[model samples]
Target: MSSGGSAQRPEGLGTRTSRGIYVSATTPGSGKSLVALGLAEALHSHTDRIGFFKPVVAGTTPDADPMVALIRSRYNLDPAVCRGGLTAREVRKYLAEGKREEIGARTVDVFSEIAAQCDVVVVEGTDLVGQDSAVEFALNARLANDLGCPMVAVVSGRDRTPEEIADAVDVARKELQAAHCSLLMMMVNRAAPQHLDEISAAIRPGVSHRPVYVIPEIEEISRPTTGEVSSLLALRQIAGRADMEREVRDVKVAAMSVANFIGVLETGDLVIVPGDRADIMVGALASTFSPEFPVPSAMILTGGLSPDEHILPLLAPAPFPIFAYPEDTYHAARSVSEVRSEIWSGQRRKVASALGAWSKRVDDAEILERLNLPRPETMTPLRFLHELVGRARVDRRHIVLPEGTDVRILRAAEILHRRDVCDLTILGDDGQVREIAGSNGISLSGMPILNPATSDLRERFAHEYARLRAHRGVDLPRALEAMLDVSYFGTMMVQLGLVDGMVSGAAHTTAHTIRPALEFVKTSPGVKVVSSVFFMLLPDRVLVYGDCAVNPEPDAEQLADIAIASAETAAQFGVLPRVAMLSYSTGASGSGATVDKVRRATELVRERRPDLAVEGPIQYDAAVDASIAATKLPGSNVAGQATVFIFPDLNTGNNTYKAVQQSAGAVAVGPVLQGLRKPVNDLSRGCTVEDIVNTVAITAVQAQAVHAQTLQAQAG
Candidate 1:
């Protein structure tokens, strides 16, 4: 909220319609950053998937939007999202080319990418550059309208009379109305204590359509920390290093006599003057000790000077802090005054104080009810992942990673830990894994690291695996030898309930990852073979593509089992279970071995579970497009609304899923293995850190489903 202006009401960065709120400011210094933080805090109470996006930011590092960085770290969000935006240079270039609409388009593109990741993205309203206030705010209004998100206007309450604040709020409201963007509310941030009630009542009649709230200035959050002053103003702290987090309540230039300046001394004040003013410097230091005098929080010796060499001895004896700056007194004082309040990522004390202040000042119950945003009816990749993480946490599962020596696995493990998605155990030597993590700047500080070769559980797991594989001619010695392998050790852990599930194969082959599980852990009851599905995240909904991984080919019966299992997997992850038996034909239009197999598989699915909606021998186009469905398969329930597509073989399923993933920019989640007794998943060897994290999350959620089924069976 420190970027500029008072805090926003509700944080919303909408990639989808009706998902986020745009918080904009009509005037400079409205603390939009803090307002956004306030909104996000409230959003956290209802849901954890909050996103922060700033469409354009100037005078900051590229790709480091101050707002996005602050909120992402504070919320422990997946860093993959909300980081993309048009830089100031890009925006200016677009504006100069008269392609301003393109800016909106790009912002929307960024929104879509993050939209999949966040339940509600807290889109920081477009920052005003050098444009006129009217022009900038009008653009924000239009952008909000274009993004189809509600707008909450922030009005600066600092140094402004109630009337001035009301007029500004009125202007912003009109801009939003003129652009046809829904105005959610108006907030007056940093309002003077005396004007809180007055400011709330003043933005009325003309502003009556939406609610108005006023937040009084909190000095701790509204004033810059001494640390910021030192860093921003280049005021080198020669003393009082311990008090860097203290807030500068007031800034004073020591142009007056020592006596007069002493009169102005107050708690948390930063005094600026020429360094040669030894009398004032000594007096200011002494004031901290007097019962009659107020203590100065810090002092800056301007003109590139410090306290006289002799006088420096008396400095630290006093509790007051001091700084040395190169600028003259006038400029130094001006610079200190210009330092605005902010919430930075690492500034814990300030952020904590700011959040605490906003929590107390804002009315929570009333605001949450008024800004009641509806949940997205469509499932997005990010939203689905959010749901998966949420589900995994609800019935917390302990997931193990067999490729702990790989950096991707460690990074993912750190992410899973940071997000609190599930309990995790990494399979490798503790020292090697730890060294790799540290070398990559990754922290698995509190995570469990189990060395498969040395773990005491290996003895128990060896016995369990040997007993389960005795028919395969395995003995205790052979099983004990297998226990040294990470995949085998990890699978054995899952089978024996040492851990709930295993996610491997990032560094191993598919056979290397799943063979152990297949050999001992085995498939669940009534399951024939382990099959897989890829949840293709199309623009509007999620579609399941089955038989994509494990099995290369299957008989009609195995295909039917895949269909049935895929339907259940879809339901478990919150997708509807409409089965489309995909082939090269639509209905009876064509015939081939593949087509016939799909048709038979469809009949078998219907026979096994009449509750599932199933359609067979359906072309891809007919299964997805309504017009094609009407022409090819009239009166069919699953033809056009198919949520699960059952491919006849692994070759087709794998090819189609990849084609869609690349051509349509769809997110392909898994080769999620189904029909396992306990959850075990594989990852691509070339998978990114995020891929590992997502797979681990999926595995944990799968483990949760497994646990639920076992509980139900025991009860029955």
Candidate 2:
């Protein structure tokens, strides 16, 4: 990761320095919006104070750029600030009069003003097109340098060969670098799936210094919606207004008989014919509801003809849209074929699919590190939870919920299933769980429910548990008796690799929930004691409180281990760790057994993890409040900006977290246990559906990291 550009402070823009990233393309139709959308969505995980700008929009209106509208609506950006700096016509007119420098200066001024309000801004460049394409590309590079932001170039690989793809990327990279723009990354969009290896191999050696992402072609994003087609031909919609957003994957002509046309139809096909062809229109409308025949997206009546009175009555209840155009059938079909599909605000499914595809194909963490933008001062709770869910949905892991009969657990399972966050298996009697879910109006159709007492795995699991616990004097009969417990059964399943992780404790105590894992799964190698942390989501930022639910009182070594583990947990969830060892007194103002223990623990942490920043014997006020920090410990780095707060004892940690959570209206999402060999997280006994969902998501992400580490170890 490298920050390759010099800082520039433009006049009249307040002292606040806002970071910006420029997303541009080598040519038109490179799917630049997809990259921008995914980048924005990814950035939202880190911070919600984001702004979007287009330096040169094609039209004058604020809504002229569909990309801007899509981003604003999806991310809830301020509408007043999410507009282009200048229109295409305006830029062209200025350039024709040789005002190139004026264009760059104006862009810089507009971008800086918007940047002042946001932590970061994503600037989109004009598409490379028209007679001035060469000039436009050159201007894009110059604008990036003028703004002092890093650039990411998107190259189209839709119909290019491996050599062509490499050459195109090289040319774009050289152009941007020559203009003193820090090229952060290159994305090859719409490449053939089968040729991905060849294309990547050809381009990697040339652009080895920077990360290159290759996205295979997805056809769903290339298909225009019915509403877009209707707008293109200026057709008057007759019925099915609600279905206008349905995608049109193919275009078909209904010149033959109804029987022949039905045979030629395909799913998402747009049927075009004269209004007099009532048989074809009726047949196409009926096919949309049939399971056997392919469904048409919509039907177009050409030649400016209206359907007969009898036909209008039949089309009133159709599920697909019906449009009337003044052009003939031939001209209408030609126009529809020439209309290029694009992602717009109205087509949510397409935008979501595009984001998902880009997320799955690209390495977002690597890109963010390369850009190395400044971190936001605070993160909202909603944005934090949304990022957790998004990370869990990528390469999903199977998780088991032991207390299935509990209503909260069942409700959480339903929500997780609906969101497709993870694969779930519930432990309980299937019939009873189903009955309870039915009465609560919860759907558990796809989730597997099993009774520990009657499941076939009970015998096998008992045997395996007895063998693993033989050293602890466990017998086969004892193992069989223990397997009847849901927590024990679920833990054995994880040990046997049947599930990736386990979440229990909604109806049980913390000891009961974690005993099974301690007996078998145990802690990771070299870990002396297990610790836990609660993510206290405050109004402005996230804070980590350690040992709140685990150790009652830890010695210096245990406390140091707890601090290290807490810092790692915070970083895993996207918060940069700045360890603050909290005590009743700040610095050397007071001396006692408690303060001495904290001072020792701080020393141990610094000795063990030299790379981490640790501050100790600090009062709560001095640790968090900037003014108090300056008065108490003036030169400390972690005094006022600490993200991870470690308490000397459980009494302080538990009560402080509760006080802040209640008094400040914060969301405490944890007792996230660390140092486990496999991910087995415990929930609060009085937890809500949202709490269970968030804990399960966190567990899934932990399992993913463990799996990656195991693969890396094996390869090494």
Candidate 3:
């Protein structure tokens, strides 16, 4: 394998440039070139600026490749890059001498030219994993390393057992050390319809860590005609109905010149030029023999140029279909490139069939790339909730009131529902709730308030409570008293699948909410304790601090549980969870009960679930500061930076987060509830209407998740 750093681009190059994709395979005759070409065409469809780089050709001549030539010609690129026809001598010599270094140099040189002018360059490697005969028999891995580009390994279509498939993948992974390179995804080309199931099953687990896309084979190659291309460019017709070889008919062509080439130009088209500059065109045309379309259709030379004598002779020797525009070559080219972007993007008649074919091949790559792209901030819940006000979903949304509900809580709920945030419901009567809200100056505009106290719920709940708690307790009065508590009743509404997730805790503690859930809704069987995550929003990134609001001074086992829960919650929010068990010191630096708890928690976490990405006993700075981490904990997974920070206790968790928020101006959103069997959030007693709405969204999401889980469980 060849090994070297990426070559730097020449300075002062134009902004228009291309990146290169080096497509490699495990073995020869695997359609690597075909796939590479298709990728180039697909990328071209997305962007006009691109260059194809094939660094090594075992049996090629002078960098000459017919496919490369076709792309250059079809795109109207500089002819100096026509490898198949122009670089035949060089390719032949390389093959004769087997001098791969020369090939590498030439490849780099060609790419340098492309990089300077293109946005992305696509480099297709020779067939097979280790086929580098043209360059010291170097491996593709080394080439990718040198190019400093990620690679997409292409495998062939064939029937194989899961083990066999995994074996093949294992070989590639081991050779490339993909874990370090982040070689994101892979493509399985030419898969058949019937083979998809078997292939998917075989590769799913093998490539589960990476995205694997299957590309079906196309039956034929379809190319658009040149006339159609021109028509499409001119917005005359949409092309690509037929294959590439179709004959093109005569079409109007626009040409610009300062010389007297109008007499040389065919008549049916319009030409723009200076009346006095016609001679400049003729002088240039006199020295050139490249075929031009016949036309004296129209000429508008700028600078008042008129047609010269030599222009007519030039026209006589030209073919049919020609017109002249008012600008020089420079302006004409600019106009064509701009006005024809649609045509360039498969908009014309000669739709490059290869481009479509290539798109199919790299469909998986596109998906993976999109997955890596950043999403809009508006998609976040906190941002979405700032606009939503009361009664958003149900017309008469049922709001449950827990015991000891305070005026602040009731007033906030009224504002939320009146603003259409939720339908307000109270444990007490409408009159009493109104009296309470009015006393607090709460405007319950559109709110539909209800009181469960005097309503039939006392009796209904009395009976339901007996039915649910018949053996647990005795005495109707005592049972009614217990059932009448807000936590018990509110939790009952959720358990009976009546309302969505409920938010409480103004007059209650976290233990109250936790107690009802454990008694009624219960925790997920897989979970031990209810952990929470706070979406800590710093000026730059959103940090997820977990078990901060819950789990005070948790033991190693509890910390492990918190770590797992936090990691999962982070994933739910689209973050690739990297759990960092935080402490005052990183690794083994500090000796203390808390440090041991964090370290032991990290170990327990790995023992319980080895698949998770967990790091422990890392200080805040070491967990988040790259510089500090590199100095103290080199190579530790969670040392340099962590997205999920797991604290050992509520004191550290709450205080640290509050300090960050107050002192650093961080927006500490959420103390989002996690590990519940169903989604229910506990709002801070001092929360605002906005907080209620956000909690509602979280509840809604949790409700949907519970519904989905029920269906999945039933199906299973």
Candidate 4:
């Protein structure tokens, strides 16, 4: 509804003509470029009209942009058709030299030229939703708007709130404007299969008009990083890293579980067995990247029974890390099988990373607590129980609702609550909810319940509505009716400030559940746009993407808004943001409306905010590959080494993303909404119990963030 400034729109200069879809998000790292690239790769099954773009880049490399190179090489586009003009170093120079006008002019020229040559362009973003001085976000959005292309929004699943999803869609739609585009689809990537139903239902209602696709979290591949291997084995670190070591090397590992040992074992390996019959086999793991081990890496000893304590002295001198589990051989093997995925996927170097951090902490127990511990053997209950009691504080009792919710979600909630992690407020017809639970073989003894039909609806609504709707919409009767119609009874409890957050949508669309929030709770002040994010879980990597669920075609400012949201999302996941601006041409090489949009957006980002790290007019390679980066752009943090990638438009956003999902076996989490006032989350109509639980967690986090912000504002 609100435009940032004239700079948000891009002026079109039709230069090149080609055919392809452009995938761009409101922000970078929202899986736009990856999606586009994947889609282009996937289209191999359909047609080959696919063309890639890094249309307008902020800087240049020695020869051209890395993204352009990828598009040229993989997508089969002509080198002449490729668009990135800037290198990583150039982008840094623009920032350092303070050449705002030069940056804008370069971007416009690049995109314009690429748009003229390519049939479809998959554009990526630098950032989309947060407020920052960066201009690239705005530039990507404007490129899409100017080019009149559609877009698909991508989001993550972890702790996503319905309000966030709704807000993202709302902002994107508002920014893109229905008049300029054909359609918009929101995709929640990396959603765990178990949570699919609940998440789908929760998010469906909010996006009924637009197509919302939910992709399951695909188990991805994870291999040891070179650093990880060196750290794990205490091998000498090598410079000039290559995919393969220069020569065949022998490595060994020793641990309590054969399963743990097997994960790090490569082909042609030898294994040691404890004097136990069960030592021979562990259950099959999800993957064995090397398929078979001709030789075992190492032999493991099981149980406290010493295959020899003498081995410990040997282990201490060995190159690999070792472990001692006080369990039987069979039990150790079982533990290994249970944690096979983790063992196989984890980098050997996480050990070094862990040890490094652990050394700084004074307490050893805390370090053990933080590690994602594998399943351990049962210990004596008395001492363990005593320790647990001593460490844990008393948990406050709260209402728990069954309300015919899915078993998995309820179980997850119970688990979290039992651990004293959260206090839940559940709504339902208590007795019926319980009866159904009993019939369904669900246990609810420890949970608290409340009946909304018999509860004081007026009082609850008054409380929540007073806080959320106060001056904005005060028609209590009308609001109540609206709320009831949309299952607002539960939402009202939250609105009235009676509850921390609400997670729904396992049985509804995002629209159905999020509508009430948008209509009642509204957006935070100065929050002009909404976008989505996806927490992609690759076998070995985790990433966050945005604006993949909403916004058909965003302007530079809107893209900027998405970028801010994405950066914050990345921060939550413990990743640093190094953004990439994608287009057909890199850094002013081409001329077109799309390039102009990216140019202005880059300028906007550099001039408006100097603290953030970002670069544009580069392709996926320049943004991700360090080797290509050194040769191409040389000194930029983002080029050929970027973690956050922005796409150009929706068609590119939707198809390309899914292609990656299906092909690379990458798991995706959200289309989590950003830029909302309150924390309300939606589940997919087909979401599972896990989805519901995760959505609840996401809502909690959002609620917490909003609360913290409110306190800060009040204090200020």
The most accurate candidate by TM-score is 2
Q: Candidate 2's error at 141, in angstroms?
A: 1.7
Give each model a TM-score: 0.59, 0.61, 0.44, 0.43
Give lDDT for model 3: 0.55
Please state every model's RMSD to the true fold in angstroms: 14.5, 9.9, 22.5, 27.2
The segments of candidate 2 whose C-alpha lies over 4 angstroms from its true place after superposition are 1-18, 79-81, 178-180, 204-208, 393-395, 398-716
Clashing pairs in model 2, backbone N/Cα/C closer than 3 A: none
> Please, what are the lDDT tens digits per residue for candidate 2 over residues 663-689?
999999999999888999999998988
Cα deviation at 35, candidate 2, in Å, is 1.8
Question: Can you write out model 1's per-residue Cα lDDT over 673-695, one digit (the tens) per residue?
Answer: 99989989988888887777788
What is the number of residue pairs that collide in model 3? 81
Per-residue CA lDDT of model 3 for 451-478, tens digit only, reads: 5555556666667666766677755676
Writing each residue's lDDT as its tens digit, candidate 4 over 474-536 gives 656655554444347666656567675667665567677666667666666766776666655
Q: Which candidate is the best by lDDT?
A: 2
**Stretches > 4 Å off in candidate 1:** 1-65, 68-370
* lDDT, candidates in the order shown: 0.76, 0.82, 0.55, 0.48
lDDT of 4 at 553: 84
- How close to the true structure is residue 162 of candidate 3, measured as C-alpha lDDT? 41
